[model samples]
Target chain A: MSDDGPRGQVGKDSFEARLKSAREKQGLDPKASDPDKRLSAPSAMGVGMRVGVELVSAMVVAVAIGWALDRWLHTSPAFLVVFVLLGFGAGLANLWRVMGPGRMPGAK
Target chain B: MPQLDFGNPLLLAQVVWLGIIFLVLYLLLSRWALPQVGAVLAHRAETIAADLDVARRAKEEADAAVAELTRATREAHAGAQAEIAAAVAAAKAKTDAESADLNAKLDAQIAAAEERIAVARTSALGALEQVAVETAREVVGRLIGSSLDPALVPQAVAGVLAARAK
Candidate 1:
C-alpha cells in the first residue's frame, strides 16, 4: 500500500507538471486564470473612456449653448464668456460626480 | 452722419436697462433655471450611472454565483456518485457475503442429509440381513427334521457362509 501510494503520488505530480507546462506554453498563469479579472480591467477602462466622452460632449454642448445665447442677445462676448465659464464649472462638477470617492470607475 | 448721437442719454438709459435686464435674467437662470436643470441632469446622470453600476455589479455577482453554483453542483454530483458507488459496493459485498453464507448453509444441509441417508442405509441393510437369516432358518427348519439340534444349525450356517464367500 505504501508503494502504491508513492506511485499514485508520482503520477499525480507528473500530471500536474504537464498541466502546468501546457498552461505556461499557452501564455497563461495558473493563478491568474480567472476570466472575471480579464473582463473587469476592460470594463473599468471602458467606463473611464465613457466618462471622458460624457465630459467632452457636455463641454461642447455648453460652449455651443453659450455661443448661441450670445448671438441671440447681441452680446458678442459677455454671455459667451460667462456661459463658457459656467459650462466649464458644470463640466467639472459632472467630472467630480463621476470620479468622486464613492463614484469611482468600478464602484457601484 | 448718424441720426442719433453716441452720447445720447436715452441710448445710455437703454443700455443700462438692457444690462439690468440681462443681469436679472442671468441671475434667474443661474439661481433658478440652470440649477434646477443641472440638478435634474445630475440626478438623471447619477441614476443612470448607478443603474449601470448596479447592472454591472449584478452581472458580476451573478457570474460569480453561477461559477460557485457550478462548482457546488459538480461537488454534489461527485459526492452523490461516490455515495451511490459506496452503497452499491456495500450492497454487492453484502449480497456476496449472504450468498456465501447461503451456499455454506446449503452445503451443510446437504452433508447432513447425506450422513442421515448413509445411516438409514446401514440400518436398512442390517435389518435386511437379519430377515434373510431368519428366513433361511425357517427354510432350513422346514426342509430338515423338526427336531434338528441347535448345535448342527451353527455348522450349517458356517457352511453356507463359506460357500457364499467362495
Candidate 2:
C-alpha cells in the first residue's frame, strides 16, 4: 500500500501529460480548422456543371440577340455568321471566368 | 412542323397563345413562387447562422474555461513544488542540527572520561613511588642493622624511578 503512493503519483503525472497533449492536438488539428477541403470534395461535379452552364448561357444570349437582329434587318445570314463567332468568343470568356486563376477557392 | 409553317394563319395564333402562356408562367413564378422559395431559403440561412453563432460562442467559452483551468493548474503545481522544497529543506536543517548537537555531547563526554583516567593514573604512580622508597629504606636498615637517612632514601628512590622511566 505504501508503494502505491509513488505509483499513483507517476500515473497522475502521465495522465496530466497526456491530457495536455490531447488538448494541444484538439486546438491545432489541421482537419478541424480547414473544412473547405471536405466541402470542396462533394462539389467537384457541381463545379464542372457550373462551368458548362456559364459558357452555354453566354453563347445562348449572344446567338439569340444575333438571330433577332438579323430577322429585323432582313439580312442574308451575314449577321448570324458574325454573331456565331462572337458567341463562341463570349462562351470562351465565360469559361475562363468560371475556371480562372484569379477565382477564389470555395467561392459561389 | 406547324411551328415552321409561317404561311399558316393558325401558327400566328399559336405563337400569340404561347407568348401569353409564357408571360403568365413567368409572372406567376416571379411574383409568388420565387419569393416564397427565397423567403424559405433566407429563413434557413438565418437559422443556420444563429446556430453557428451559438456554437462559436460555446467554443469560445470552452476555450476560455480550458485556459483558466490550465492557469490554475500551473499555479497550484508551483505552489505545491515550493511547499515541498521548503519542507525538504526544513527536514534537512533539523536533522543536521540534531546530529551536530549529538556529536558535541559525545565529544564532551569523551574528553571528561579521558581526564578522569589521566588523574587516576597520576595518583597511582605517586603511591607506587612512595611505597618503593619506604621498602628500600626499611630493607637497607634491616640488612645493615642501622636506620638509614630518610632524605637519602627518597632521593635515591627518585633517581632509580627516573632512570627506569627513561
Candidate 3:
C-alpha cells in the first residue's frame, strides 16, 4: 500500500486469491473425524455390575470371618448375629462408595 | 453340615486351591490385562489430546487469516471510496469552472445589449425634438404670414423640451 507500485498490487491480488482458496479449503477440511472415538474401558452398566459384586464380596468376607471366629471360640450364635449385622452394614457402605457421585466412571 | 466343617482336611485343600487360583488370576490381570487396558486408554487419551491440539492451532490460523482478510478488504474499500471522492471532486470543479466562464460571457453580452438600448433611446428622443421644431416653424409662419429661422425654431423647441423634463 505504501509503495503504490506494480509489485504491491500483484502481492495484494495474490494474497487475496490465497485467502479465498484458503477459505474454501477450510470449509473442506473434515474436522476431527473421530474425536472421542477410542477404546473406553466399560459402560455404566458394567460399572454397576462390578459395584454389585464388590458389595456382595464384602458381605461374603464378613460372613467367612464370623464363621471362622465361631469355629475357633466355640461361641456360635453370639458372634454370628453381630458379625452378620456388621457384614450387612459393610456391604451397604461398599455399595454407597462404589455408586457414589464422585466415583470415577467405569471404576472396577 | 459336614461340608461346612472347617476341621476337615478337604477344607485345607480348598484353601490352597483358592490361593493358587487367586494368585494366577491376579498375575494375569496385573501383569497382562491391566497393562494392555492401560496402554489402550493412554493411547486414546494421547490421540484425543493431539486432535485437540491440532484443532486449536487450526482455529488460531483461521482466525488470523480472517483478520488479515478483513483488514485487506477494508483497505481496498477505503481506497475505492477515496477514488470515488476524487472523481466527484474533479467533476464538480469542472462544472463550477464551466459555469463561471459561462456567467462571465453572459454578463459581457448583457452589458453590450444595455449600451445599445441606451444609444437607441437617445437617438429616438433627438428625432422627436427635430420633428416638433419643424411643425412649430411651419405653423408660426402661416399665422404671422412670415417665415421663421431654422436656428431659432430649434432654440425654442430645446427650451420647451428642457422645461418638460423639469
lDDT of 1 by residue, B88-134 (tens): 99999999999999999999999999999989987876675566666
Runs off by more than 4 Å, candidate 3: A1-108, B1-7, B52-103, B134-146
Pick the lDDT winner: 3
Candidate 1, A41-104: lDDT as tens digits: 3366676776677677777888898889889989888877887788778877887887665544
Which is the leading candidate under DockQ? Answer: 2
Per-residue lDDT tens digits for candidate 3, residues B1-166, read 9778988999999989999999999999999999999999888767766665575577668668867987998999999999999999999999999999999999999988988888887887788888888788888888977987768989999999999979
For residue B51, what is the lDDT in candidate 2? 58
TM-score of each: 0.43, 0.50, 0.45
Which residue pairs overlap in candidate 1's backbone? none
Q: Model 1: what TM-score for its first chain? A: 0.48
Among all candidates shown, the one with the greatest TM-score: 2
Report the C-alpha lDDT of model 2 over B1-166, residue by residue, as the tens digit: 8668899999898889999999999999999999999999888767766655565567668668767986898899999999999999999999999999999999898988888888888877788888988888888889987987779988998899899989
Which 10 successive residues of model 2 chain B have the least lDDT summed? B48-57
Task: Using TM-score as the measure, name the better of candidate 1 and candidate 3.
Answer: 3
- DockQ ranking of the models: 2, 3, 1
Q: Which residue pairs in candidate 3 have backbone atoms (N, alpha carbon, C) closer than 3 angstroms, thus clashing?
A: none
Which portions of model 2 show Cα errors greater than 4 Å? A1-108, B4-20, B60-79, B137-147, B163-166
For model 1, state the Cα shift of residue B43 in Å.
Answer: 2.4
Off by over 4 Å in 1: A1-108, B1-36, B146-166
